[model samples]
Target: MYNVDDVVMYGTFGICKITAVEKRNFTGEEQEYFVLRHVNSDKNVFYVPTDNEAALSKLHSVCSKSDVDALISHMNSEKLIWIDNDAKRKEEYSRIIKEADYHEIIMLIKTLYLRRKELGAAGKKLRSSDENYLNLAENMLFEEFAYALDIERREVVDYIEKHIA
Candidate 1:
């Protein structure tokens, strides 16, 4: 039950604002929908059904600076046990992205970062699949943090680095 102007992280779209909530009789049925506009985009609007729990669950409240600080504090100790099997790892990555849990996303980023470093040290490159998820996770995290912290998206990496123990 979000009100107008309330900011929330809407799945991969990152932070968005609830601009309106109304019942519309589309498809010959009246149902409530939350009209959302992306905080960073001027023209993107999303109409999400109010009662769709799966979709609704994707809408998470933007984390505060304190929350980000807490996440950073735990970053070093968070264990990201890598799944060596390609198929299994992909499936796990998909679940993490879909779930979009802040801590899990951080773990994904940290895991991939460490993996990339290890590969580089061994004269190898990160696998394409890993690279793709790494970028996605970073994008999701940076967008939300930037919006909540009132900073540019490019600053998130350095910001988190400063906070990480």
Candidate 2:
């Protein structure tokens, strides 16, 4: 139930501004769609069905700076769980990324970051799958954080470090 010009977090697409809510008979039946324009990319646009609750469930309002701070603070006390099985770990990572929950995404990023550091200290490297999910989680979380906190994308890591250090 977002209105025009409302900014929302649309799953992995990151921050999107609702440009319009229009009814069109694209499938031979009149249906409403929320036209979203990606805030980070001018050429990217998305049309989400207005009545689809499952899809709409993924649309979350942009969090406030206080919310971001709270989430980061919470992360300091959260425990990291690492799955040893690659297949299961990948599936779990995919689910967390797809769900795009702020806390869960932070967990994924924190877990992978620690894992990467551990592997590096042992003279090893992250498995390709782990690396990919880490990057995806970081990108998604940072994008939302940047838009919400009014900071540049590149500054997210440093911001998090300063806040959580």
Candidate 3:
């Protein structure tokens, strides 16, 4: 359970600050909801149910700088098992992304970069689905990384490159 002003990661919304924990009835029952606002954007606000396990599962911790560094160090070892069939790959990768694990997300980004490079060499491009997944994964990972590491989101790629190179 997070308290007010606690920053957390939520699915594709990335870094969010818990603004309040109040009982609101958007549905029908007056149930408790965690009110959150996007850290980067005031326009985006979310009210997440306190009792919904699945929704709450998407609410995750924002790593500290040291923790982020540790995760970056592990980037080399974390990798996705490549599925050759597009449909299978999409299904498997989607599940992996939705899991919201940092290690797995780093792996996903690496895998997509490699695959995109391979396809480029062959005069092809990443499928639309793959591209969308890549964008989503990058956004989620980098937002938390930027907030935690105290760096601009655009600097994340360069930071990773310097660390892992």
CA lDDT of each prediction against the hidden true structure: 0.88, 0.90, 0.89
Ranking by TM-score: 3, 2, 1
Off by over 4 Å in 1: 25-28
Order of candidate numbers by lDDT, starting with the best: 2, 3, 1
User: TM-score, each model?
Assistant: 0.93, 0.94, 0.96
Candidate 3 has its poorest 10 consecutive residues by lDDT at 75-84
Clash counts for all predictions? 0, 0, 0
Give the Å error, residue 149, model 3: 0.8
Write down the lDDT that model 3 would get.
Answer: 0.89
Q: What is the total number of backbone clashes in candidate 3? A: 0
What is candidate 3's lDDT per residue for 31-122, written digit by digit as tens? 99999999889999999999999999999878899998999988888866667899999997899789988877888888998899999999
Worst 10 residues of 1 by lDDT: 156-165
Runs in model 2 lying further than 4 Å from the true structure = none
Candidate 3 residue-wise lDDT at 136: 88
- The alpha-carbon lDDT assigned to residue 118 of candidate 3 equals 92
